[model samples]
Target: MEGYETGAGTARQAVKMDMPADQPQTPIDEVIRTAYDNIGLERLETVRALVPRVGMGGLSPVLLNKIRPLFKHTHLVKDEYLFQQDDEVDFVYFPENSVISEFQMLADGRTIEVAVTGNESAVGISAVWSTSSAVNCAQVCVGGDAYRIEKDVLERELTYSRPLQRWLHDQINAYIKQISQKVICNTHHAVEERFCTWLLMLQDRSRKNKFNLTQEYIAGVLGVYRPSVTCMAKSLREKNAIDYVRGQIFITDRSKLRKMCCSCYSELPPRRVF
Candidate 1:
């Protein structure tokens, strides 16, 4: 059995840090001011349009316009690290078309995905009240466009906006629910069932039928051996639930895949947190 060793090493090597250690960190206030200055009318409109779509429907237009300047559009790539474990989160990412996965690394160096964040919610929102350092490692699972705001800027806005504060608390509750369910699924479900559930969840977040993911990567995310993923993939293919060639996986039959998935799949919020 090829355990997490090889897969984990590959993930570690593939991680592209947003900020390099050699680069001097800019002051947060200055970064915010610069982003504010660079904000264009079109960009602000784009951000405002995305707000309601991403579960912030209650935010007033006035509030949205006020903070629109604080946002900076960002394009993230696959395998990019938003923030590593124990590192202070400098920005909160709101993925418009991207999917971000948060993993908890074990003492033995193994890791398992605990939560996934996509367009429905933002990542690193816990930085509002939680510790400065991140508890899990966050990485881009599917690459695309996203919007980010400086942590300090978001914190400052939260102080006076009761709606925003309530929304953040609701998001945090949903996050906790997802993580708790993941634990139950990992502990009680079969690998095949879990694989099906994961595929459905990924498809929901990425809004794509096909994904560029390898068996090793799937194994690492599930904390299983590479061969286990291979077997499960083969089984899924035989059932016409999915199809894969090398690093690419395509959902061939959504109905069949859903049938094979565990109850956990139906339990998750629809078109919301994964």
Candidate 2:
């Protein structure tokens, strides 16, 4: 616990080197040392401020204190896969300003995103029900930091904290609702409308107006042809709703995007059973 901090105003501590000065370093150790040298304490504090954005905002102090010990703060890069389908559920991640997409692969090798969860939801909710494997592939669409906890520790804590259990259940229900709505949207909505809805949803989740996403990735998530996504993106750019260059996109006119989106954008309300 020498390099760990648990409090309201402090950032989690970095790893302290206790080995002898002449000790040989492993490849992994060298990488970690480099990372520690590069990431400043101020940046870690900035990340700590975003932790409260995870899940419901009213977590009891007792519950937070109990669970904080199990969390390991780490950064997630864009396009990184947290868990692949059928993989053993080892950890649950609480993202902060990170957009995670749950995608189900089809028989024809195509993938379709079932849900997009941000700070308000935690990935690997299957651990709550004691599931042994991942149901879908969870990938980070927007790069950011997150607190990850081992599934065993999380399960133990969930068993002891009723508030935590209830909160997680509600979050899981909200995620299920998102997947259900997306299913319907993919089936009935036009490609352009669905694209707008997806973009708006990503923006809301990441709380950022700009994104580094390729058209191929967008098409995969939307379950549409890449050419179709290219066309739609171009049209949106022409309408001044967004700006796209290479693989990056920026929302230039949010009002126009809102107008172009279907009612489904706002219809999927976040519900709580607690």
Candidate 3:
């Protein structure tokens, strides 16, 4: 896999170099070059990190070609609010490079994240199940490209595709598990365990062992004070599990962190995603 050459012929060239005359070629041949391949993957790296199947939907050519335009080019600003709690819930978003956070707002004006949306799946589910609004508010965590579709459109077409429906259900199930476990971890676990759990979850969608984060936001997600988060992060770092510096977190040893985390990491909330 030195390169991403997608050739199925005697000879062909990649985006970096063309093949000689006796070669059979396909349009994808050149695009699979190492440099070009990375550009493609980085574009949706966030999405793939979560679902791992965004590029494999394999929709029929007719259907894909028709809907492809809808997603091929879309944009959202960094830190933009996509929607809020109790909105009409008429659409869901498939973010390409962005990270979307779903939170529940408490009466005290604090919010707790229920799920995070990145690649391979839609962010908000309001339109998916025809619910009015389940998200307190969703914001762009990474601020990148996003694909959006009306809820009605996906629902109508979903009836004809079992695979797509199944994928959607899987995403929902993951969301519920995230929210439930986070709630229990927040309520019953010690701060250190909660910090480790948060790191474990974030590790799933980050591009590197080092991540962009802050204790202030972690506190918001956990519905706790900033000092509490700072204390836990410090303890984890002291244990050689992770390090925090200038709004960034570096995971030193994943296995150690997993071991240090609580049992909620093992016991997830039971809910039907679909």
Can you give the TM-score per candidate against the true fold? 0.77, 0.76, 0.65
Candidate 2 C-alpha error for residue 71, in Å: 1.2
Query: Where is model 1 more than 4 Å wrong at Cα?
Result: 1-66, 272-274
lDDT of 3 at 22: 34
lDDT of 1 by residue, 163-228 (tens): 788878877887888899999999999989988888867766665667778777788789987888
How many clashes show up per model?
Answer: 0, 0, 5
Predictions ranked by TM-score, top down?
1, 2, 3
Per-residue CA lDDT of model 3 for 9-48, tens digit only, reads 2111112222233323633322222222232222334534
Clashing pairs in 3: 13-19, 14-30, 15-30, 47-119, 85-136
Candidate 2 lDDT tens digits, 1-274? 1111212121223334333344345444343333332333334345446544434222456776777888898899999999899898788887767778989999998889988877666888865567568889999999987778888888888787789889778777777787778878988989899888887677656656678888889888988778788778778877777776666777665556767987677666322111
Among these predictions, the greatest TM-score belongs to: 1
Report lDDT (CA) for all predictions. Answer: 0.72, 0.70, 0.58
